[model samples]
Target chain A: MEEVKVYGAWGSPPSHRVEIALKLKGVKYEFIEEDLKNKSEELLKYNPVHKKIPVLVHNGRPIAESLVILEYIDEIWKQCPLLPTDPYDRAQTRFWAKFIAEKITPAVRDAMLIPGEDAEKKTEELIELLHILEKEIKEKKFVGGNRNKYMDIVSLYVIHWIPILQEYSSKHVLTREKFPGIYDWIDQVLLDCGDIMENLPDKNKMFDVLRVIFGPRNNYKPT
Target chain B: MEEVKVYGAWGSPPSHRVEIALKLKGVKYEFIEEDLKNKSEELLKYNPVHKKIPVLVHNGRPIAESLVILEYIDEIWKQCPLLPTDPYDRAQTRFWAKFIAEKITPAVRDAMLIPGEDAEKKTEELIELLHILEKEIKEKKFVGGNRNKYMDIVSLYVIHWIPILQEYSSKHVLTREKFPGIYDWIDQVLLDCGDIMENLPDKNKMFDVLRVIFGPRNNYKPT
Candidate 1:
């Protein structure tokens, strides 16, 4: 059997997290592009519980969820550790990673909704979230202290899709001025992961696809 | 500094999860119950982000979130290993642990809302969730593996609250008939963590506390 295979849509940050980690770890695998609009039976079969993308099939066994996939990838390949070795440090990284995963949905929701219509309150909440993100991260290369780590691969790096969110919402949530640390983390991660931007499907194309599901005025229109 | 201290609330599954883990690992720790209605200032400071209960303060440092605290306790004590030693097994346990945690809120929400309205639909969704649980845990000693493990502690084993949900919702989603292995797990964990139930506050009494927040529920008085 082939070593590793990833079932992913071109647009999802969750998929990219696994992709970048696999590339960084030099894990060889087939890449399957799942058209999320018309999801394949294979993807559905693999991840029946959530039925979502970023399903990593390794050695014929499929692991669903990006975090689950990331952990699985880290376990098999030890070339470059995505997480710190110290138990406390590992916990700290995990705490932040979990925090981001739990909070990101609400953050984006707040960013996209109409101002003053519950959306306004959410937008403020989103800024507060960004502020926390800024406080935790810095100009230092990664969220995990000066290295290209999992936290950075997921958090600081994923905001490359912000332009799409902004185009849809008509409001800029992630200007460099408000969060220089996060901003620098973004630039550094792009440099660190060569041609990472190119890996993401065209932003405008992705946003258009999601608009039917996400709503207008603050809808997602890929860059 | 004392050996270890847990700030918790009576009968809360998250806090109970921590308590069970501590008992299984044979860790002697002082339990400080925080009346969630009137939360302690100390808890606010320790878990500033969430400010919710079940904070494990070892020496001076505090760890928030039940799953995180469970891992912390396992690492600090290291006697009765709650998680598997192998990385694959550990990852699988973590995956289910997270899945359960993510859904507990939604499941509990279903049980709380007025039944027989749109709640019928929500209840079916709830049953579907339990079926997933039932399938994953089919006839096994516990969610993790052969022996009663962390997944049991963190998931259903923490509370007899399932009975409370069944009675209140009148749907009886989780039961021994449908899920015998899990029922067996319930029996084992109850044996393992003796008298923890006595430690839990009366559910009838807790209803009085929750009713104020949830607003009055007509037709069914806490008799």
Candidate 2:
């Protein structure tokens, strides 16, 4: 019997990424909800370097980082493949995934935390990034092709978390008209893919949690 | 006929990563050195998003970002596989590789750019990160098992570039005594692997170019 476990938080976008991937691959996994206010000892033990959530443990070994976990899941299960078979296509998918993870997500979060003119500047920067992504998605049905794949799975943060971020910040940059390509992708991944829709955390709960964490009164600085 | 072209710059550690991976795979390719000051139209055309070098053009399709390119090379060529065959081992390798690329490299660079008390603080932060890596490497002969592989290749930035950064900033943080495990692995990769040794950019040349770009007089902020 193969034992798989995910140590993650409910409101965390990265944690949701892990759950969605597992659900997509039809792999049975035990989800251990972690408290960001006071992280579990196992979370720290599994990921000593960063001490971040969404660490995937299979049998006994632990894998940290959502992107790394996604690849591991695809490799181990070898069914309902996330990544494309061709090397170039896989590279392109991985490229966009990395851009989404490293660039877009951070910019979105940064846009929220900052206030005033700087926030506007950051929002603009994010818009520029979204434009690049919009162009990429314009030519395809989804980032990962016909059906939701690795890139689409990686983009859950954009679909689910960005709205909460926008609501909190009150800077609506990701409007449907501005990013029609990405907007269509949003429907395809969230609505078309029942597996992903089933696995997502409640958005209002996420917004509420985020309010406590990054509310104007709190001097919240991301680590 | 498979045509592989690397658009890279000397003195750029990310660029070196692409070269090392290609050499390890015994993949024949042409190297196009880009002038970072005035980048070529081809480099911009190939990597429109970032407009950065170390873009791997395999059969006219370009892939930017060194880590992505390395994975592409490994997947396509498959000789003397850079990543391990076991799924868990591959995940561990990838986890560390991402840590190195995203966390370690940026910290190292940030440490160089900042000055005074901040630089010292950044240096300490970098040392803390190195300690984490040291613990991981203490048990291994190389990051990539017995032979120099993907993790080892990814760590070229730490082995080669940190020294330049330290020299430029005048902060000696990565001494052999401070990080013995990493030091030993560095020798194993640089000294033992003739391919890597032969392919390295001239260190002094790199120093000169970097000095022109980031010297004290120049208000050089990395984009």
Candidate 3:
């Protein structure tokens, strides 16, 4: 097998999704950590389009976009299939995955970048989107069920990114009752009934990044 | 073989995407057109989550989302391959397809939904996005390349939808100078040089729908 190299940030859901896929597939790859603020030339070279992490280089061919990377990994290794063998099921997975991917960055940007009523409005819309997400992902073990697939990768985006909203506004956009299925699903994916606190990345670190970037109430300092 | 049925909206790119996939595969299926304003119960029922069109119901199993439907169609009827056999290539195709899908909706929305500055902002962004799309899609036969794959299906979003942008805004986002590659590709897709154009629904009727819903814009005056 040719060498597989992944350029990524430590705590990004996109990066995490690729990491889990490679791990599940048992593909040996070297990881190069990137400072998003100061992007490395390798990251720039590999992913000039987005200039983001979660870029997968296999046999010197570069593929960006975490969702794209996951699909690529699934196809190459084929050890543990991330997508369903059946066409309909695979379509369902991709629909939900794309829906999830489309919502994530915008939701985060609204919370972290935008301001005023627009920010709050976008947050409300974002929460509504998450509810739709929770409703759609209520079935099976993982989003893909007993086996992890594209949906699970998308789930990481939600689980990991929402904290920034919290640190910035102290508003829990993802109220417990609102998204029980998804909240429960995350618990299942990260900490199964038999296992506790195993798969999820550190909560503190995620919050820390959010707090640093977004600040509290868009100003951070207490009046 | 179980029965195959598709519920979709006439002149919709998403709907046409699934249709193209079916046509390419030579799959036999019934097409049900739904009025977007007055959606059918069956359409709502088949896709309870999205309540949108381009739902493929195979033997009572319903799959929604045009991209998802394309994937489903390809999976079940493999005669005409919609995705590349190689994982990386497939991923690359999908990356652009997904990128195209995400941008087209918003870009069109930007051009049509608002007016003045907000609309202009969207148009500028849409132009930038179109340029990116043109550059990225420059390679291969289609987004799927050498053949119509899943990307080709999703690219219908562009074909069915882009004209609306042009018709309403009094400008073509994809012109020979700005998006020569995209202009050429769309021409190829719609001109019957490739098998893709044969299946496309009429673009004029789509303009009729937009006019009825949005009234007269910059140029075209609605009666």
Candidate 4:
């Protein structure tokens, strides 16, 4: 008997990444919704170093960091392979996934969440990065090549969350005219994979949460 | 026919990581030393995104980022496995490796390289992180049990380069008394594995370079 549980928040991108990966891998997991304001003790105990959500606990052993969790899920399940079989291809997939996590994710946070003098500057930096991504996209239907794979799953935030994020925030950087490649990629992912829509948080509910989070208190930064 | 080329700098820990992994795997390769001050066209061509070193060019195809390159090497050359074969164990290995790369490495760069108002704060953070790592070290002779594996290779900076960095910079956070676990682990790695010392940069040479780099130009931030 295998026990799997995912501790994550609805609106958090990193948390969402884990859920999508598991679902794609066809691994049945218990989703434990965590309140961002008041985190559960298990969450803290599991991930003491960062104390962040999106932890995948397998057989009571907790693995924190969505990227780590995603790789773990892929390795264990092995049904629908997330990474490509080829060594070089796998490296490329890992590379882009990491690029999104490290570079783009932080840019999203800085641009949308924080309100300060550097807002415009941060937004510009994000635009510059997205354009770089646009070039990488370069007519590829999915980040992982054809079907939705690990890189594609990792990039869910860019397409789904970023639009919602743009709605709440002052900056509107990811436009169709500017990032046509990204827009096309998003459409293909959504069109081809109907199952992806299942676990994704309700848009209006996300907006409601974002409205409060990024509402009058534009400076309200979530941990 | 297989041709492997590594573009890396002498003093860089990330660069050294690639060399160590290659040597461990018994893969014969050519080392192309890059003047990080004036990065080559090939380096930029290979890694346009970051344009940083420690890129592994297998045949003609180039793969950048030390961590990504490490995985590539492990997958291709199966003789000496960098990661454990089991899924859960591999996850553990990757988790620790990522922790070292993302968390500890940045803290080190910030604390030593950039002399600023937050130097003290950064040093404290590094110490806190190291202590946390000390707890993890426990009684493990090597990061990879009984061998110098991927995590051990990644953590080379923490033990080898950090002392030299401390000598160059004012902050001496890593000490024997304060971090006995780390110190013991370091001694164990060096004593047991002699090949690790082969590719490691000369201490005196590194000091000379660091002394000039961190000299009067305390604000000299390298790109």
Candidate 5:
């Protein structure tokens, strides 16, 4: 087996996605925590394009971007497959993953990061997006029906990050009554991937980090 | 073989990406051209989420998003593989594909669509982005090296659309002198995939569509 190492930041949902895939595949690897404020030279070297965290180094070769890394992990480790085997099903899985990345994650991030009126608007948009996702996941126990697939891993932003955002803003973005399917799916994913679930950053710590990142709401400007 | 169909617009680079994949794989499929002014009901039904083209319908099921459809095509028809067999190589291919979709496409689109000062800024940004891509592809004949793959398909915007933007704006965003590697790549990809090249929309038609979509430059507001 090739030596594997993960460079990630705590409270990063994308990084958590990589961790979930690694844990699900039962791949033993070293974890190098990146101080996002003062990023490590290794992280920069591994991912110069984005200069972001959650880079998986396999036998010294680094792969960046969480979704791309997840696909690589799935292809290399056949046991406990992350994606469906069927071509159409795999496409569907990829579609949902892309959807989460494009729609869900950004909206959640904006809702959490932006201040004042823009944050409120982003929160509304986030809820609307979650409503659409609720319909898609209504029939399945997980995002990939019964199994916790790539989409579920991508959806860690919703399951883990939303609560932190809610606490920070003192607003309710996700509730059991409003998004029953998403709520259930969250529980199912946590139950299915307990080992990874156990290691997620604390909600209070996440809120604190977000507050520091965004600073006071009055002076915040969308970048 | 499953019944295959493509719902796409003539001037859409993403739509063209799907068409290229199907053509490269030697798959026979029906083509339904969408009118952007008034999208067909079939397109709306097939891709309700984004209501965007192109949607690749296999048998009865529909797959939206060009990159996802390309992956489906590659998986179903293995003769002309769009992704690398090696996991690391596959990851790199995916990384470039994502890079094109996220960074390159949007920058190019904004450079074309936005008006006046914003467009100038976007054009500068686009040129910078192309410089980076030039470095990535400097050593390879194509994005996949030796063959047209997913990144090459994703790069259709840069190959086909950039020239039209240059013609309209007369700003020379992607010149041979500045982007020699990209120039070589554009020629190589067109040569490698001549059939698809032959079917690309005329330059004037694309400019007209851009004009209509973005409206007059004076009135254009970046969305």
Candidate 6:
């Protein structure tokens, strides 16, 4: 097998998603931490289009976009398939994953990026979106149903990032009662994927990065 | 083989994408046109999450989101592969397809949705993105090289919609000189995928739809 490498940032959910996929696949590779402020030449060369973190370099070729990387990893490493074999099931998983990437991730960014009433408005929108997910996950143990799959991996961003955003904003957007299914799903995913839980960036480090990236807000000061 | 059905709108690029994929695979599907103004119960039932069009139903199971549907069509109907067989090549194809969906589509939407100075600003952004794509396509006969693949299907939006947008705005965002590779690629795609060309909604009808949806502007009065 050719050498595998991952270029990513510790605090980025997309990066973490790639790491989780790699870990689950039990693929040994080099982990290069990127200073997003000063991206490395290698990162620039590999992912010139987005120049974003979480570029998986397999052999000499590189794949960008966390979701795209996840798909690649699944395709390359057959052990513990991230996506379902059934075409319809795979479509559903991809649909939810795309939803998370396109809708949930951006909504969270908006909630954190904007301040004051605007942030609150965005938070409300985020909660509404979570409610939609809650309905979907209510009956299923995991996003792919009865097993962890691509949707579960992508949902990690929502599960992990939402609490950090709440802590930063001092506003509770995702409540246990409101999103019970989501909370249950998170607990199940964490219980199943111990590696992901263990490898997640420390909360304080996440907060520090968030403050640096988005700036501090009420009662949320940089440490 | 199970019954296949496509729920789509004529003027939607995403819808066209699904149509092209099905055609390329030679899959017979019942086409159900949904009125965007008043979406049918079936569309809502099938795609409750997004409540959007371009849903593919197979054996009474529904799959929403155009890109996801494209993948589903490719997977089930293996007669003509939409994605490359090699894992890495598939990853590259997916990366570009995602780039088109996430970055290029939204930029074009912004150009059309925003009015006056804002629209022009977005138009400039769109052109910059197109230039990036042009560089990628310059060396290759098609997006994925030597064949019409997923990237070409997604790029259909840029090829078809850019001219219509230029007509409406009276601003040539895409030109033969500026985007010769893209023009060549478009010609090739149209030449190869005659079904896509034949099934595409008329340009004037598309313009009428755009005017109705986006409203007439800059001396481009609604007919």
Interface RMSD of each: 2.0, 0.6, 1.6, 0.9, 0.8, 0.7
Instruction: Give the clashing residue pairs of candidate 3, or none.
Output: A142-A145, B82-B149
lDDT of each: 0.71, 0.81, 0.71, 0.82, 0.79, 0.81
Question: After superposing candidate 2, which stretches have Cα over 4 Å from the reference?
Answer: A113-117, A139-148, A216-223, B113-117, B139-148, B216-223
Best by DockQ: 6
lDDT, candidate 3, B8-67, per-residue tens: 877667777877788888878899989888999999888876788878889997888766
Per-residue C-alpha lDDT of model 1 across residues B154-185, encoded as one tens digit per residue: 65532477666555444566778877766766
lDDT value for model 3: 0.71
Report the interface RMSD that candidate 6 achieves against the true structure, in angstroms.
Answer: 0.7
Worst 10 residues of 6 chain B by lDDT: B139-148
Task: Name the candidate, 2 or 4, with the larger lDDT value.
Answer: 4
Extract clashing residue pairs from model 4. none
Residue B121, candidate 4: Cα error in Å is 1.3
Candidate 4's residue-wise lDDT over B1-223, tens digit each? 9999999998899999999999999999999999988999999988878899989999998889898899999999999888777776777778788888889988988998775898889889998999878877774433335443777788788878888777667467899999998888888778766777776888778766876776634443332
Fnat scores for every prediction? 0.28, 1.00, 0.94, 0.78, 0.94, 0.97
Task: Name the weakest run of 10 consecutive residues (lDDT summed) in model 4 chain B.
Answer: B139-148
**TM-score: which is higher, 2 or 3?**
2
lDDT of candidate 1 over A65-143, digit per residue (tens): 7887787778888888897765555656666777777785557755663355576778888788777778767522333
* Tens digit per residue, CA lDDT, model 2, A1-223: 9999999988777888888889888989899998877999999998888899999999977889999899999998888899888887888888888898889988987787555568778878999999988987886443346443787787888988887677666677899988888888888777767767675777666656777777642433332
Model 3 regions lying over 4 Å from their true place: A104-115, A118-127, A133-150, A158-169, A173-180, A192-200, A217-223, B112-114, B137-147, B157-164, B190-196, B221-223
Q: Worst lDDT window (10 residues) for model 1 chain B?
A: B139-148
- Candidate 1 to truth, TM: 0.84
Per-residue lDDT value at B93 in model 5: 82
